[model samples]
Target chain A: MNTATAPAGPGRGPATHDIRNQIVVAATEHFSHYGYEKTTVSDLAKAIGFSKAYVYKFFESKQAIGEAICSNCLAQLEQEIGQALEGVEQPAERMRKLFKASTEAHQRLLSQDRKLYEIAQSAAAEHWPSVLAYEDRLRALLQHLLLQGRDSGDFERKTPLDEATDAIYLVLRPYLNPLLLPHSLDHNDQAPTLLCSLVLRSLSP
Target chain B: MNTATAPAGPGRGPATHDIRNQIVVAATEHFSHYGYEKTTVSDLAKAIGFSKAYVYKFFESKQAIGEAICSNCLAQLEQEIGQALEGVEQPAERMRKLFKASTEAHQRLLSQDRKLYEIAQSAAAEHWPSVLAYEDRLRALLQHLLLQGRDSGDFERKTPLDEATDAIYLVLRPYLNPLLLPHSLDHNDQAPTLLCSLVLRSLSP
Candidate 1:
């Protein structure tokens, strides 16, 4: 298979990254649809018009590919949450923004990036170590923000930060499951706003 | 197999409903140890020293047996929650009790009825209509309580009851996952309580 054209004035720079990204996206779709047990490296390679050898050139193994894709999905989620809370001064406002950003990202995963969500959930169930590490990372970020809120006197929590973070993640659990979405969820953009408002009501000082 | 003396009856005077309670306890242990996919009617019969025919006398199928077990579990949960909220006039106080009761029930499920918890979670994911119906029933109960709190002017302005109930369910999702509790989760329990408290605090007038 041939490469999909390199970047202009660059020595095969963007194409390399683009091809890897494409492979990651294709792999995510395969894992989500067929589940991790059924998805194969060959299937992922075929989807992106690349030979097995070419796919291997980017990813050392299927596990490696999964790690890369999972990390990317999580990193993007972390960024979205951070951006949502950015520049919000009020504790309550920050809390609202935090939930809105997180839920919107979750909704996007259910719709546009359905595969990523499926992959993440399935991975967490079957692949314990990697998923646990990912969970820890996410939890740490949440813990930091919660502590910040508490220090700023925005939050009046008595519980430890880790437990509080767990609470936030648990509350958002249903939103992560694709099966629980309303029939109108796809058309409804107000989900994040409504979810954020309610969550804020739950946590406001 | 022979019957287990039929609760000291005279030559078998048709085992009473209380005897049925004994069968349920035995069945719970069997299901918890063997899981839904592996446990069988014959096994349960052997465990209780009752013939398969005798076991069939009370329940129609393994599925029927499962339904009975789950119904009992939910009933116990409802009772505990009610007891926790007993004599609690204020909404916030009621919420604190509710969280404590729910956590206790959750802990019991983790330690004593793990098999049923696994079955219920899988059932929920697999779209078992009964599981969904039970969950809806729970949501309705929570909504009723929220309405009562609102009517009493104890709760502050918040989102609609149905949506808030969904948020509460989401917070409880982790304990429902068997994998998350392969070992005791006494430490993890703090998060959901804190989350519940935060939300309740937000709603306090």
Candidate 2:
């Protein structure tokens, strides 16, 4: 067995990093196709052409791999939302695009891989710190947008910033919740647009 | 044994009606003090000094009794909300009072009897038709309020009436969800008031 393929701490050579990334990619594929309950560590290792022991060297257990997948997905979502807001000077326009981008991204991801969506749901329901932290970041992003709207005179300053943030988050939950999006799509394809308009109108100057 | 005490069909004497009401009251107490899983037909029968067979005649099963309790609670809540809206001509004031009355009534009942709340949660999760019907009624009430607001020029008619109704309901979920209100109360006692103001502002002309 090649010693370079073995897992090592951070700052190790690129060989270890590559191997860890390979494991995660393979694990994600297996999880998406086979679901969490059915996908075992051995299956992930086999997909990556590594031993089960080699997989364990990097991730403590199957659950850790699932967490890593969820963390990566959330990070990617955060980045996508950030990119969507770029080049939009108006706060109202930015808010509209933000909602559109966020909802579309979530709906697209869930539709592509239902098992991955289930893992995300489980992580949220279990109150995983990583997922919780991501939620806080999302809320902060909305709060910043609301502040921008107020400063730009696009939104009236009737409600306090914090209260407005909570209100928007609560109102947009149906659009943001992946589990509910499919149902919403079936019920009304234009739900995201409708909700976005309502949210903006709520903040009208 | 008193033949009059036996369960009878509708329009049987007033005595039969009284006994049925008595059974429902006793079952509600048992289900409240003890959880749904622990409360049995025998226990209810014991509480009301009736045989288990007699209890079964009145209610097909323990679940039937729970359903009756939930139906009764929802009816009382509906009446209270109706009363709260009485003599309030201003749309904003009516909306405010409606939210306060609804939230307070739910919180009060859940605090008084947690078991009933749990049953309600189960009913929602299971998609019991009775609970679904109640939800429809609640949404209709809000829709009526929103229509009145729009007609009175208190609210701008930007979005369709149905969409606005949905937006308000989604935003107020935290206040209206029985399982969530207790936790929200623990986190912030003033959430209902804050949400109400935000909702009304969203509808302002």
Candidate 3:
């Protein structure tokens, strides 16, 4: 697990790291395509041109690989949202940006790595510990953004911060949810914009 | 399959219907207590003092019985909401009553038939056709109500009625979801009222 020891050879410089990332990416794709029950470790190894033993050396099991991929995807999403909220001063503008960024981030993921998005969706529904933990973390991040909005007078008088945060999530749940969005809308050219508008409308002060 | 089969025998009259109802009621209890996959058909039959074969005659399979029970539960819920909307007129009031009624109806089902509620929750997540059809029907019913409200000029709105309808459904989805509120508030409790208020706030002109 020593990070500095990973690319210890001349020819394998960065190749080892790339291989692991590729396996995680491929596993995510497979999980998304077939769902948890249908996906297999051997198939994932085959997809990435790695021996099953090689894959196992990097990750203990298929579920472990899935957990790591989801962890990485969600971490990147959370980081993007945090960065987007950095410069905005007004509460309402910040709230608006939060929603816009959410849709944009989601769209970027869906467009670039659709299978990974689906895997994340399936993981969210299942009772996996890692998935649930990541969701809790996401909820906390949104809560912080909402609290910031409230402090700036963007949100109206309402319940406490936690409740308000939950309300916001509730409103956007359908659109955030891969399973809930209309299939036509999911693939539509204008989906990201339309979805962002609808979400923003719900949050207007 | 005949629509006009003779009503059992002289002594069997209400007892026959009672026994059948009891079986379903007991099945619900068993399913709630043990969960759908864990509960057995024989356990249900035995709980109601009947043979497994007799239960099969009443229901072709466990899944068939589950489907029947789910339909019965949803139909009853639809009937309750339809009844609640009759004496209400104002748009806001109608929306309030709808939420209240939905909460109460879900609570009633949970209290009276927990197993069925749990089964339906799992089914809803798994894309059970019956549950999806039931949700579609419920959405249509809600749409009709929203259209009526629009015509009455009770609701102030910038969005189209269809989008508004979907938004309202999104808001109410948590309350209708037995999986989320299994142990906490009763159906007609404070959460629905609070959430509905937030939704109505968003919908106002």
Candidate 4:
């Protein structure tokens, strides 16, 4: 089998993966300076020191590039939440940490890099695959925390677990979402802390 | 002031109001077919058999017309929620009816007239004044309901009234929001009903 003759099959090769990472890095920087909607593929290609065709070879469109950047940013947020919950003894406290860490992570993106936050906002508004995947991971994490609370006799067991998890996720959505961040900020009078407390109360056995 | 010289501020006269309604109706239809983003002011004027300048006399821009339509739709939703809660004596049950009616009304708009819904979707995502006003009225209504619940011995009164209302509003936001409607639909398997129950349970003494 001639390795050179085989198709890359969506960045399967080590060299191709390296190039993809380089492209993502440069595109993120370009988006940060120029904003996601204002920056064009040609602009990204030129900034990355690659031909327009080369950039197109890596991404089908500018949206594809945006999706990649958004996915990375969201993954970082998820990791922050995971670390925030590590070694936490109480399930309710673990949930509070998750909410606080997620809100803080999103607030940083919203304040420090509004351009990147816009990418995430569009991703959520448009239902991009990256956002869908992030939401699924988040729901799973919440479900795990709920189960922990149930087993510890800290939460009611009568409500169906899956439905309760989704309901809980819905309650946290405004704070967790990029688009709804401004809405959350409007009531910045310890709203998140109080919301977490209310939700914890709902879960009490 | 001379009657002829008096400036009619924003839809004052009967004749002017009639023309404005005509423009709104025609623009709503145009937006339904071509979408809000694609349909231009010029295109709308042509459809309504009026000059572009004449259309501008009523509305400053295309977004202004969109705002008018969004305001009307949201007002209707508010009215429906009010009607649904009417005559419901139980505090928790009143909350339930409010949630159901709001969800149904939005579902109708989203499923029946997505173009109008798109106008609403943009209004919410962009934080138009219409939505801001609607949120204020909704919050006020919820506060009233919480007070009812407290007085009737149905819900706990320890949590600050305003914060609890805000938390309940957040839980219902995903389903009520046109932008997040699709996301809510994904979990449409009794998610709304269950979520309402969960919120009501949180209010238990």
Candidate 5:
């Protein structure tokens, strides 16, 4: 269904785009306050002063809305990492900044609100296709950095690029996954540095 | 509670020690057939022709019985790995065999019975202290092998023993964790070799 041509509400208060944005914003709050399983479409619609039917018009289901929030959160995280790596030419320095940025973003999300972290955990555990796509994008980013390092004579090309990427991901799993590294919350500063050091050593010529 | 003095059953039956062994054997079968949650002390006793009180005399609870099974399985796995590396003196060769034995043992356990695998998954997920102890033993084994490699000039001592051990575990998580490496069932032979190669390369002098 073309959402753009969908019938507008009676009152001239907000446009359809504004309503969609409002729904997402309110849904985020609801999800953050109440866990993914607890929040319902009726509760979301009641909070936003919209009919349940109208909420359905914008999102197909509660899971779809949760996915939208997860997608947006991950996209924002990627953008932050990208912005951090801008103008960083050296592969090692680029990787350091990338990991630092990724860890800090996750730490912030984990500390700011636990429900958001729960949503991410659910996304990963449930194998949401969008989350997997985001992981692929992250892996591609690492591969690009590795290739640059190889070209600059900083890293040895001892293994295939794909295998190397997998290696990096596996090695950094503890640092990347909050669920796996609970102690990281206490030693946030040291964990990333140690992990980055190991990665760089593995890539060293 | 001193279990040695427990009274024997009627007839020319086995002693209390044998009865305890019988309970564990019967419990393993029950857990492997019906899973951890479904199997109960009463059912176990009924299967072995003993009273529920007698089963309780042997095990504290159902979770305790599950832990016993998990501990026994992990101990047997460690013994198998130790036996595999019996004649190998070289650090690199020993590591290769250790990993190969570990992967093959886990694969065997996973493929032999679905219920057994599920019990292991539950044990790990629940973080049974016995399972954690087993993991620490495995990590110590890896650290010992790494130290041997460094002493014999097979591997570089670029990183501290603890950090290197952590790195090895991180890199080998997929190979070691059946849940993480689902694709391993198909490529069992190549997976261990590929993982060992990456590990050895990372530790190359």
Candidate 6:
């Protein structure tokens, strides 16, 4: 029942953050083996030599722990996509790189941290805030890119930007969706590139 | 272990099929509440007033019963799509109809029988033959429609038909996917038409 060593209040320091990271590391290991749903907070505490209350100080609930993991993974995916899009001037080529990079990045990320996909799948199924926030950011990024295309006169302005961004996001969603990614990576390795080409052609003025 | 009243031998007729249908109906009802993975054949037998042995006679395994239900539901979907396309001239229009019809029909069907979506999710996750077969048929349907567009000079033939079909199918997959469909129908009612227009614009000869 003791949580004296755990971080308290809003003014906690880096040591407190390390405790948070420790809990996440232990929870990830537990979730990877037993899955996110079946493992209880108590099990995680026992695995990490912390009291359940101690664990609670760091994460409000099992879902919060999952959210932390899900957020980090998505951030990594965003970084990979950013690297892929780097120095690309034209919106059309940027669009192509965006598709290919996301597909490849998602595949690599999930494949490497196979356990993380399980957490993400749960996050997606439950509409976790982390997933929603990521979706919002990605959508804004897409809308900005589409605006570039229209402004440069490289793409038609017939379709509303929101609608086009949504449609393109829909097409890319499967690659990002944990439930759908395995099939995409395993069977449809060429899909992202082909779909991007099709979308770009559709955007021609 | 008695299965005295069960139809036997290879010459089984409509009566045998009736028994099979009966099992599927009961299983669907049971699965709707308990879910597919949770319910066993014995539970189905008790619910259907049949001996477990007799139930096994009709369905060699639980998945067989599930397959029957999955196959029937997909058949209904195909029929609905077929009716949507009936008398529609022009491949692009037909394509539009195909997208709209499938999206609408899928939403209607799944919403009307909410439990059925649960079963479908399982079948899709497991890659049941029924799902694979249905995907194949739908792909063939799209390919045929695209070929018609190409022959009539409505669509550009620059992109290979296979790649176009696959890319388009990838867009539609989210709608067909049990995991993704609920979200699509609930939030993206206009996506089908918007995407179809985008794809059609891309196909301009």
Write the residue-wise lDDT of candidate 3 on B77-184 in tens digits.
888988998878777887888889988888777777555566776666566677778778877877877777667765555678777666666566656765444523
**In model 3, which regions exceed 4 Å deviation?**
A1-75, A83-97, A100-166, A173-199, A202-205, B1-22, B46-49, B107-116, B126-130, B156-158, B179-191
Clashes of each: 2, 0, 2, 0, 0, 0
RMSD to the native, candidate 3? 7.7
Question: What C-alpha lDDT do the candidate models reach, one value each?
Answer: 0.64, 0.76, 0.66, 0.82, 0.75, 0.82
Tens-digit lDDT track for model 5 on B77-150?
A: 88998999999999989989988898888778887888767778777667788878877888899999999999
Q: How well does candidate 1 score on lDDT at residue A94?
A: 66
Ranking by DockQ: 6, 4, 2, 1, 5, 3
lDDT per residue for candidate 1 within A39-112, as digits (tens), equals 67888788768898888777766777777777777678778878777787776676667666766776777666
Taking the tens digit of each residue's C-alpha lDDT, what string does model 4 give over A1-205? Answer: 6656433336568877788889999888888888898888998899989998888777778888899888888888888889999899898899899888887887788888877677887897788989999999999999999999999999999889987887788777767777666555653546667778888878878
Q: Mind giving the per-residue lDDT tens digits that candidate 6 earns over A111-168? A: 7767656788788778888888988988888888999999999998988788788888
Decide which is better by TM-score, 4 or 6: 6
Cα lDDT of candidate 6 equals 0.82
- Model 3: docking quality category: incorrect
Candidate 3 has which clashing residue pairs, if any? B32-B115, B103-B187
Docking band of candidate 2:
acceptable
Q: Which pairs of residues collide in model 1?
A: A202-B198, A202-B199
Better of 2 and 4 by DockQ: 4
Query: Residue B158 in model 5: shift from native, Å?
Result: 3.1
Candidate 1 lDDT, B1-205, residue by residue in tens: 3565122333433555656667788888877788876878898899889998877766667776676676766677777777787898777677667667776776677676656676665554454556556656666766677777888998864466766666555444444433333322433546556666666755676
CA lDDT for candidate 5: 0.75
DockQ of each: 0.25, 0.27, 0.13, 0.35, 0.20, 0.50
- Kept native contacts, as fractions per model, are 0.42, 0.38, 0.09, 0.38, 0.08, 0.58
lDDT for each residue of candidate 2 in A40-80, tens digit (9 for 90 to 100): 78887887788888778787677778787888988999899
| Candidate 4 Cα deviation (angstroms), residue B35 | 4.9
- DockQ, computed on Cα atoms, for candidate 1: 0.25
Clashing pairs in 2: none
Per-residue CA lDDT of model 2 for B10-69, tens digit only, reads 445687667778888887777777777676688778887899987776666677777777
- Candidate 5 per-residue lDDT, tens place, A31-100, comes to 8888777778998889878899988877778877788788888899899989999999999999999888
